[model samples]
Target: MLNREFIFSNPEVLKWIDNKFIFVAGDDWYRRRAQDDASVWFKSIARKARRGKNGSTQQGCYAVTPKGELLRFINTSDPKKFTVTMLEALKLWDGVVQDKKVTIPEMKNFDYKVNVPPIDPSKDVLIKVQSRALTEKDGKLERWNSNGKAGGKPAVGHLWIKQAEWQSIVQNFKTMEVGETTPLTKRLIHRIAKFHLIDNTRGEGPAWESKDLKHAKVTLTRVKNGFAIRGMFLLTNQKKSLSHSTELSGEITINQSTARPVSWTMIAYGKHRGEGKYTRNARPGAQPLGFTFEFLPASKIRPIDLVPPQHMRWQRGYWEAEKH
Candidate 1:
């Protein structure tokens, strides 16, 4: 299912000089893994990215770690920021030499939504508490005095939704690419070291055995509140088993296959912000954010989405010969 030209096309990206190893992986690897994940060679690279420090470069096509490792690369949502930082880094790294390495910078925007849990309904209390402060004269709050003390002034307090309407929320995903210049954070480095990339290819001959497998690229998506994220994935084989789920603490209310009729979920993580909501709290922290949708038949989802690719391109190929 993989072609040779596709595998070794990006020579610059495929070749690297590091203190330890040299490897090349990018579009070819991503495509191959995306296509037939059972291909033996696909598994090798898959293991490499998952088991090694190698990750994608800023451009999102492909990149190598300083230690000489292959990784899936991506760019941040803000293209300008990525370009500026990369250029600056290149200038710094080049020093006297005018020639600078063209690198893609990783981009990730963190947005946080504060959630207020719903209050229980049933409660009994005496109506002894009486105050003339908040009573409206003409359906409006009464004016207050300048003394700061309440003189028929309005009583301001927390507002609660007596009844809430269920609105369809859209789950947005932000992609970030990693590169040589990309600063390695302690948490990210740790994830790369402990992460496990798996290849999910449908097996032939015996239904249970893998026929021809290829590595697959799985990324993390940060979504807060109760909004559900959806995507159109290429299911090459109709028989291929597909399942969707989160890998973190939040709950998965609805996991649907078809897009025609979307699904909905109540009681989720964070708090819901109206339409086109945006926050600055979503980030990688104590709870690794991501969702694992194992192409394999039997799999479960965690709370967060997998980290999105920093900068990557869609290609139609695989990386097999390199391993063989």
Candidate 2:
């Protein structure tokens, strides 16, 4: 059971009497309230509440069709800004819903600031992954010590990945300091990324997590084309059977123009012990991996056909048959 009447209806909601929408709790979304359906045409917005800047959460408003295609959202939920905000939503709904082109408010600079690179999808991004022992020259392998060294040019741990349309892409990968080529399970790559593509496009939306983190501090700022949101939190608990826990810090570079992540990176450090396959040769403590995501335009993505260099071998992990 949760609070259902948390959202108050005002005169602004009256005009969209025919539209259908759900009013959910800002703190907990599972609680739902009824909507007013006094009109004939069902046009509404798919609104949800998210943690806003300054360590507060607010319910965002949206204008959408019956099928739940979003037209626009009201960014601010401040009482003082209600009148002006609703006025704007009204004009957008009237114009777009009515299918008559209407002039809308031009997006301007935000109230906060952060350092973010200006992104232009017009240019193709060259996505590359640097490796330590994956490249060799004349039967000699270039290796990176525990102190940190990037191997060679050909061992450029790059992948012929597919194009995607989401912010966060998390998938399990089996990697090690194997031969000259760190081959990945191509099928798993396709399976994981493709799964998110469908889930992201649907109304499921990004994981709206609010608990399980402590001493969390976040600084959010709107950048040129989107937002640069960085946050840090402490995790002191781990599952009983698990021998590792981590203090996590992550940054999400969101393309506000599209509400998709332009780049997302997470750094974990604290205590860790390898489990499963790594148990036989797993080291304890201080294994920090710089997991980064760089999204590229779908049109620029090419087919992946990885081939090992001369005298180098490829090691395919769990995604494929245990082929050496």
Q: Write the per-residue lDDT of candidate 1 for residues 1-324, one digit (tens) a residue.
A: 111222334344234222222343333333333323222234344455553224332123234333223334334434444344444534444453432334433423211111122222211100111112122345654432224321222211111111111112112211222211112222221221112111111000011111212222222233332223322211112344421111222112223222111222111011111110111221112211122321111122111111122111110111111121
Candidate 1: global Cα-lDDT?
0.23
TM-scores, all models, native as reference: 0.16, 0.25
Q: How displaced is residue 212 in candidate 1, in Å?
A: 16
Model 2 residue runs over 4 Å out of place are: 1-220, 233-271, 277-279, 305-324
Q: Pick the candidate with the highest lDDT.
A: 2
TM-score of structure candidate 2: 0.25
* Per-model CA lDDT versus the true structure: 0.23, 0.30
